[model samples]
Target: MAACVTQQNPDPSFTLSLSAVDGNLTLVQGEKKNITLHIERHGGFSEAVSLSLEKKGGGGLPSGVSYGFDPSVASGSNSTLSLEVSSGAPVGSYDLQIKGSASSKTQYAYLSLTVQEKPQPGSFSLTVNPSSRSLELPTSGSVTTTTEVGIVRNNFTDAVSLSLESSDGSALPAGISASFSPASSTADKSTLTLSVASTVQANTYSLRVKGTAGGTSKYAPFTLTLTAPPSPPPSGPANATLLRSYQWLQSSPEGDQPAVEAMFYRPRQFKSGVNIPDEEGHGSIDDAGAYQGWDVLTPPNGGKHGSVWQYSKPVFIRLTLNRDARLAVVWRADPSKVPNWLKNNWSEQGSVRIAGSDRRVFVKNFSAGQTVELGSVYDPGASISQNLETYWVLFGEKDGTPSPAPAQLGSPAAEPNKPCPQWVHDQYTTEVTMPNGSKRVLATWHPQVDPVYWCYFGHDHGSDPSLFKAGYKPAFGYIQDDLHTSGVLPEGHPGFKNYVWERDGYRWLFVHHFGTGAIGRVCRQFHSLQVAVANKSTGEIVADLHINTDFGPSTDNNTDLPLDATCPPEVPTPSQVANQSNGERKLHVYDGTQGSLNGYEPWRSDVPGNILGLNLGGLTFDTVNPITACKDPGCSSLMRIGTSTGETRLFAVATDPNGPALSIDASKAAATGEFYTDIYGKKLLSPSDPGAVRQYIKPGLRLEVRNERNTECFARDAFFMFYEGCALAADVPQAFMNIEGALSDKN
Candidate 1:
């Protein structure tokens, strides 16, 4: 067996060799190209080899120019090499060396890449700061206003030439002309000067600014609202202030009677009626007896007694004691109390016995020592003998002896508890522990101003803009998204119950109350986190601004918690949309996508290839494709898009909590529970109104864009590649679950 045997050659120590199928490539900046890299295994080497690029020396690959291999590890012998150049990359030639190695043996190959200037598409774009601007020009002379314009481009960088002119069919006022500084340049920004002759009409003018670079050209719309100079202030002493007084109704009967415990504010000088003194100012009259239910003293025999007091001027007041002395009557002692008899209505008052209670006490004129006899003070009418006996003992006799008790009073009319207006509820009532201790109820009969406003405001950490940006949790609530989207709350659903408007600069919040369920369990509860303000000048409604406090976690027994001291940064980001305009705003929040319900992220495009392309350089997307990232419907109408780092990047839209994968739509107004920008400037919806949601999102509603929050973020070109529904399940993080309460099947 040894004579003819030819031993198999020993496996050679692997020697690796690398070569490129194509040794050279020519590409433009911001372009991506691929080359085939071949690995040769010699001397019977069969093990896999890993490949990587090597820097020649002194300098590395041009800034933002990168490469990678398809098969990162060479399995057999070949792999595809991918080279990419960023849009901002400088044009230059590069000599790159790639290396492949298996075992201890490595081989190298050379690649020559020629990078050329990126070609500009046939279109370029321009953006003007403050797309809508205003200027005041005097009637006698001339005036000048300036706006800055920026050139916008993608995958291209060249000197953009500029031309300014009046928009089609919208010429500038007759004498107005436009000019640009450095008419043509490669700079990103340019100043536009507008000069208006006194002869120009004072009216809004539409203007257009066009930019041309390479072979591409684009234009932007600019608005110039010209108005006459403001008029001088009145030269005389201001008009006498209207001494308006606000008297709260402390107690109201099922049927009409009179307000109990009336109080008044002393008149003071004021130039404008808008600002009212916050404190009680001063109380002039007292009506304590009316603090008790006024129905008991309804003048049994149809006698005028417990009636509303409408005081127009300073006057004498009188009080009458009932047979039992428990009932009292407050009426005007002087006829002068009537300012205008026909127009004067019953006046309400504050109770002096209770520190802060408002009562609807009777106010009417009665002659001094007037002996106004009445039958009885009870609904069924009291006995004459008993009434006389008690009356004699109390009024006739000046002694301290007490009189006999009168007959039991009849119950007031049905539905004794009528709901008060939200504003009234906030001003006169407070949350108090009920007898059963099941839930808190509004103490309607309380005697003090509701301190809820001050308490919540004290917890408003968003007072500082920076802290709000850094993610301060605010004590707020939102309507259910499902209800809002349907645009109509079901008939049996709870209505908006109570809210306070214009507190702390038009900020307000409200709650919804649903009656107990079959098992006597509380069924309905909701909260308004933020409110909207409307522009008085333009009649626009502004929503999407949050000005409030953050609340602590909710327990099974107590859904409402006290305000938290601080909002930690790690907590899920709350929903916050800046008010791009003046006034109150509205927002609808759901449990959040997968319970993380942060804001929306429109920058994370849903397009197939674009999903992963965001991390790579040199990728550009057509922004007009509604399915692409930047292509949300009507995005251009809301904002202008541009880039600064020479990269063809677009703006980021709103985001939701799940992740930055879906984009929010800014073009359409949000329905009841849908997320929305402050589409309507300063317009507000009545939380108490059943139809408020549908009315708020009516398609005919056209609110002016205010941009008060100074937000210019627009949808990136990549945002519109695909649409992600709000119902998409999100990856709920563990930390968020612990903070926002763990989710259950019902949740």
Candidate 2:
């Protein structure tokens, strides 16, 4: 191979080189410097290089001198190194060896480090109070003056010596002297007094305050401005003083009770002759051309009215306080100084302290329901018309009710403490049938409590077993059998309806609530339905069972649509008629028809039916039955007539598509002579066509006529309740109907 060496030179191999960027460096105790090391690949070396440090002669690193690399192992020959020196490090020079190794090849570099002991009081700062000032001097010559200043030490723990000199080339203002109270201090606060003499030039200057502590020094900068004094503000009538006055009336919005409290403000305090507002404020009308703005309250009896109690009258007092000083303006209403009328109406013995500091005021006992005035007379020199600030509080009751006591103000009247008579807590028991054909006695009711009709009105679960124990389940959520036995509807049936129905003998009572629930439980309602077989046929009647307990929003803003989302859309209104024809007329009164077109009527469960009409005598018969049967179509009831006379008229009714109901048919039928019915079932006058009212009678309920045209209806039974329009009205606890023989077969 040695002989063959001439044939080919050994192939070039890759090698790595290491070097120190800042190899030679100097450091002090507690101080450190960064020394970089560079690595290079001479040929094609691409392997990662690892770095470490050691003393040059092969011992461990110097005590307190630590070294580290951001990445101990550098990829592709590159990484940063960090070095630190502790304050306790020995003061000496040392050389460290940095070795970088890659692939079995290693290279070395040197780092020179020197340390020194840490210096005392290494950091310090200074600050001076009243950092700047402006002095006023005469134009001809300077004036002597003195101002108190302060010096503060910051971040300097050791004692500090202070000295002052002109920072700018002003030479301490020619005879101006500056000194600190104690001259030297480690304290945070010290007084600095600066004095300037006459004959010094008026100029702005900055002062340099020096502080030396523990062999270290710092400087604090302060500024001063000196100028000729401004000519005394053109002495005159002290800038037309303006004092505004205010008046507030505390009164109830409805009843005679006055407002419990009223607040007002005083004229804003001014700095001597500065910050004077050119215009009046605090409701002053002084500058307005007409009796407008704050000046409207300027008159002595301006706000007095028959129903108003005057508390104070607007007046202005012209007074002066020593220049550069503040004084109090006390406002007291002495009964001895008030007018007789004011003392009799209001508490004229009260006092209000303005504090004369802040411009705010508050008054209590305003509900005394009386008006007040400041006093009978104004200050000797004060004017009631100009440049005066006036203020007053008045209490009054416009509602005509007597004034409430001061202690009872702002609260409702206490209710009488009479115990409820005819009231007793007692138990009630009844037998009920269960779903499994078992009978049980229910004794959940109070015994001898005040007799009250128990009625459930909203969409809440019913506690009675008949409501849910059969096969029906709640739609909202799982409900316990015991909890569901008390409400009128399942816990969440959605809609607005009140009704009970009997089909094939089985009776079902249902009610719907729209957006109804306890506080925080309000939610949109849901739709529900059920079906079952019914066989019994004995005639039964259901009386007033559900009463209106909740009123909807006073306005129509909250009117919701059909209770069940599956219901049809609303329809247009039907045509009105002056007279009914012999032929059957359509009622157009169902939920999806024109007669119930309004948003409110579409959800009414009480008025849904395909009603037909017929006219007899002066009365019209609008019924769910086209023929003479009241069973097929439910609400076969009589029409209620208005107070109008002679003329016959017909009005359409609101209806729902879910069931059947009745309305009215206005048509002039038989022209036979007058006929009337007494409170009894007897008829007066010649017998006329019974078809007129027969078709409109609601089975057992009857319409008794007082005149020939059935213009008025008389209440005969104890439970008399009917809808006067859409609103329900009750005349007695019971109701009865008188049906003529002719209408007997119509039921």
Candidate 3:
């Protein structure tokens, strides 16, 4: 007995082996065929795994054979491939290299794919970061990620030099290099603080950083971040240059009544009108008198723009007491129709709304002497203890007075008695200690609600193009996987989330809010992980793509794409699929059945076997049947069927986290939480058999393809064959829990 050392280890182990596989190569010029392959784990505690392949020496796998992985295939089951040749493929047998191992293993092996040549897509990364500010630019050798001012290079074309083209079409300082920040930073980060000479066109401009890496160079992403924001000259009623643009609200166009503007506090007299602090917030306005809550300042029902009282020109609403004689203007809300007699200058656009994602220059104007608060409330993701962490910033007059910036939201006078949490990281944030000795946290920022940052980006990844591939994580919440099929994958279903880390391994992609899906291309370095989404409110991924980031436990979370160019399409290997008829028996199998609502069929004649075979090397899936007590209605539109082994797979529509499985419908899947078990004994996906082959077999615990007599129809020709899902090879090592060898790989 090969005392499988890792067979019982808490961590993962690997064993690589390759073998040539075949099924059918029905392809056209520029098209590829998907073939079936198998994989086995020498030792590891994990019962499930995902396998992938890469045509190592880069020319790419043979154009004739497009491959994919399917867990439907037992450890030694078959997955299919498509064969498509390009106009200039070096016809004949070429070695199609493949790589993969069990999800439970830390090792991987190489396999060979044979076929004719054709054009294939490759992948690469170009990243840049660091963005630290120095008093001056360094005068020295090329700046690489290893040092400050990291040089972002073309991950594909390591030889290519970066090109900096500003949005304003201006040139950059010579010798200034661009590169991806170390795993410590993201390419979207400010890598270099460019201070152009006044003589350089000082305008915000579009920027595009280009260069070559690997063997070839193609147009990369248009550097999306703005390089420079326009420096709007300071504006305030105190400055004579700006004072001329105003007309005091207390004074009529015909004359003036200074007393109206001096009810509680006296108003300042500027040359042109009155000098209210543009730097002052409503907080600065004296509130010592009546109108404490602006209760006494409501305008008549009808004001200008349909309000009674409106600002003719200048109306400074301060937050705090601005001066010894000041009347704090809290609301200044216009109610009814304004005196048509008054000429108002403020437009609806001039008013500011404090929603979120408002970190913009426009904020400056609306906030000049605007009502403000001291600090911001940490809209805790939920009403949970230790969830709220309020913070404040430094804003207001430069008088050096002890005042919280903009506004002091919570008891500013007692702020000294309170302290901020230890984890607070704002530069201006502080902690407050109460007399009771309990520590409190107070931090803040002019928050931009739900800021979007990319962890990884790639073009054209999803089965459809509109689906943009993106990976993301929320700043303050856990990602919710709720896509119908995506959210509830059965044990035997072939889906992304269905793939799991072997026992003890805690590894899985955390997608936050990528909207489109996966499509498009940008330069790479698989920089910090990021995801694209449609809307912050919706929280949907655009698409799933091959994204890389500096996370996990190694290299401080830095990850580069594994591509010199867009390497050829990867062909995945076959994996194990379990069958739980009479006993809980498991076996490895291959499956690739990319399906569409149009191709969904419950029978073999409706579709041909292998026709729906997954392109494991590329994008593929299995139509695993659910083994549950679900009460949900089936969608004829999304009805997916499996070419099970004639009749030994469970048909569960629901499951119970603690109770036995139930054979129900969709409606009950989530509501009941029941686990549907299979009493039939059917083997995992295998070639079709005839006659009594399936007589003794029972359905599987999962509703995936079972191997038996009736399965023969789907053996060689089926519209689509469903199987269990496979795991990502890159996410493997991170899945290790305690294996020394597995941990060593990460280190």
Winner by TM-score:
1
Q: Which sections of candidate 3 miss by over 4 Å?
A: 1-159, 167-170, 173-204, 213-216, 222-747
Q: Using alpha carbons, what is the TM-score of model 3? A: 0.18
Q: Top lDDT: which candidate number?
A: 1
The clash count for each model shown is 74, 43, 217
Better of 1 and 2 by TM-score: 1
Candidate 1 lDDT tens digits, 413-486:
11111222244333333353222233333322211111111011100111211111222122222333332344
Better candidate by TM-score, 1 or 3: 1
TM-score for candidate 1, please give it: 0.20
The Cα RMSD in angstroms, rounded to one decimal, for candidate 2 relative to the true structure is: 34.6
Ranking by TM-score: 1, 3, 2
Model 2: how far residue 241 lies from native, Å: 44
Candidate 3 lDDT by residue in tens digits, 562-601: 1112211231111110111111111111122232211111
> All candidates' TM-scores?
0.20, 0.18, 0.18
